[model samples]
Target: MSAYDVARHFADSWGLVFLFGVFLFAVGRALRPSARDEYEHARTVVLRDEEPGK
Candidate 1:
């Protein structure tokens, strides 16, 4: 089969479903931005070494 045939075959199979699901998931996330805030939290501590108690 040629490149065109392979492309067309993929478009008709799982490709379309995968694209549709990704699009819906993106929209759903946009509609509920709050759901992602927990992921935005960061917990980190930075310490610097210094000469014995000045």
Candidate 2:
């Protein structure tokens, strides 16, 4: 096979897997119990009257 065809096949398979892996990692991190408090803080930080510099 030509170099371009080889590259395309590799990307079509490995690139998709890599992207899916990244997506799963992000979803897993976001849903973990340990992250709940941090997410809660971010969700409410705007409601508080804290300085923007902080």
Q: Highest lDDT among the candidates is held by which one? A: 2
TM-score of each model, paired residue for residue: 0.46, 0.78
Candidate 2 structure quality by residue, lDDT tens digits, 3-24: 9999999999899999999999
lDDT (tens digit, per residue) of candidate 1 on 1-54: 999999999889989899999999988886687855544442221244556665
Please give the TM-score that candidate 2 achieves against the real structure: 0.78
Q: List ranges where model 2 is wrong by over 4 Å.
A: none
CA lDDT for candidate 2 = 0.96
Candidate models: Cα lDDT each:
0.74, 0.96
RMSD of each: 7.8, 1.6
